[model samples]
Target: MRQWRLAAALIAMPALALAAPCELKIGAMGPMSGSGAQWGLSMQSAAELAAAEANKAGGIKINGETCKVSVVSYDSKYTADGAAAGANVLAGQDIHIIIGPVGSIENAAVKPVAARNQQLAWNAAYANNALEPRFPLMFQVSPPPAVWADLLIKRAMKTFPMKTVVIVVPNDQTGTDVAGVDAAAYKHNGVTATTEFFQRGTTNFAPIITRVLATHPDAVDTASSAPGDAGVIVKQLRLAGFTGPIGRVGGPGTAEILRVSGGLDVLRDFYWYEAVPTDDPKVRAIDDEYRALLGKDPMGGTTFWSYLPGARLTLKAVQAAGTDDAEKVAAVLRTMPVEDPNIGKGYWTGKKQFGIAQGLFFPFGIGIIKDGKNLGVERQEAQPE
Candidate 1:
């Protein structure tokens, strides 16, 4: 009888290993509506793709059980209060990792709430104070303007010479801070910069365009303004007969700008910064990987590719930590080498300005359109100068 019982117990051990899998929840966040929708959706798409990839590969392993990766998303409505609300909502769901809250306002509001909830969040905020040593759990997702604005401005100057520039941005912390950095870059290159601000929700920009034209700037830069707003500004500026090169030193929205500004003909002589080298074969293949995992076409533009590596790295940290605890995951993230299968190797930089070496620095791209001709994006290696 004892030998029979031992034989039954040994046979049942295999069944225990094959039990139901657990769930590993990760949160995706950003503004999912209104003008800033494109940026937020990109973060969400990247998060979904990463989770799908992890699930396809047998999910995340915690303890001895295989856990299926799940993504929860929130739309912060492009406001500080929205992000704070989203953080609390995700925390209520027991989510310990969050992927975004794209703008400066959103990031600032969400950081404290996330820290209080013991959550690790990667933000796409380009604000001056986006990263701080005090919030060890908060990380900057992409290289900010201070990191590459000089290179972008120098390259744009090569294509379109200018002694003075007017940057149009929304009246907000992100707008003001980004414009300040971009203005410094222009000043360093011997070009005087003046910033023009508009209310966040004004549809028609004729008045502001008139004000911007009064300065007679050689070029106009839509620095950190939403794509819809930038397009309107570009359209109105062209209508106002200011036929100067339009440059965007803030975020990646060339496609949206073109669409809103009536395509390349209207946006002729345009130069801007793209978050990623969208033309590279290896980089373009990121979409193919997305299709393989998500079974859908990619959404948004450069941000989808740009945000992917951060989401991948976050999950990698979760796996390395062997648990979803924010502190443990953050510890693993700080120690792990910055690299992504899609975006390739990156750097753990941001100490000079932010006082924390937690920002992810990746190679960026410069895009140009000259006289109605599309001149594809050129890759710029990440030089942490």
Candidate 2:
């Protein structure tokens, strides 16, 4: 019996040695095919970059062992249903945490699924005060759209003597949310906001533009999605003879906005609220690397300044947590605040950005398209008024 016990112990020792000392997997979901595909794809690359950098540095130390990281990516095609489906699939796997479902509507739809699985979701586009009451496992890094809306209104009020604003939003739920925030912000700022809704695929904005133009508002505040939608709206507005500065709140297509706008010099001085800036050194390095690797500037895809910092923050939290357990990592994430150069120079207090005050949060950067082809970023610190 003693001999048998010794042999069994020896056999079990090797198995234990081969077991991963520690391991963690971060799941990323985005629209790789649909309208929002560019944001999703870009985020995946950024997460991969962070993961690779972490692993190359000898992985993260967790508990008493070094934890290896694995990245799992899925495409949500920019739809709420798609996001929920992708979240379900990823949650079914042995993932330690999740990164995104790019848009706010998608985030809202899938956050409950993450809660059901007792996992963490660091969604990219959610910044609403309302989210706190819903999903506890879910956190948003971007400033609430209402804040951006207020900033834009303040900008317009200062830059131009504008008295009225016309708001255009996507007819979808996400767009509706964007409009709601914009209205709230305008009211808070002592300005009146008139809103209009449009379907996602609608190309002809003649009627809507005409109606808004009739309102003869001092400026047009657009809350549609990406460059494609915003570009279409701007072009149609211009064609309909509206010359006021057009603004977008949540999803603005900084990369392809010019191209999609038909090079009509419409966006020459166009202003949109940006989450980060492209000029940060770390962001610049990543952009340069991407340009070298892709043989062209990564247009319409993930750009360093736009959507990837959140991924880096997630990885950093995992590294900081030093464990693969979802709950443990989630707890660490709730309190992790990042000041990465790539994100901007401002500060994002985790308490203000995340409901639990223990998740990852970073500063928001405002960007503008200047001289036809560059994103000029500005840093501002303002709480929701």
- Report clash pairs, candidate 1: none
Off by over 4 Å in 1: 1-20
lDDT of 2 at 254: 59
lDDT values, one for every candidate: 0.89, 0.66
Give all TM-scores, in the order shown: 0.94, 0.81
Q: Candidate 2 lDDT, tens digit per residue, 1-385?
A: 9999999999999999887656667787777665566677766776666666677778877676777776799888877888888888887787747767677777777777777877677666643542564566676555556446677667645544566778887787777777877877777777688898888767788888889988888778766565566777777887777777676666545555566777737665556765654445665677675555445554334343555666666667767876656677666765654556555533343454344443333444566544454446665553321
| Per-residue lDDT of candidate 1, residues 115-174 (tens digit) | 999999989889989999889999888878998899999999999999999999989998
- Residue-level lDDT for 314 in candidate 1: 87
Could you tell me the TM-score of candidate 2?
A: 0.81
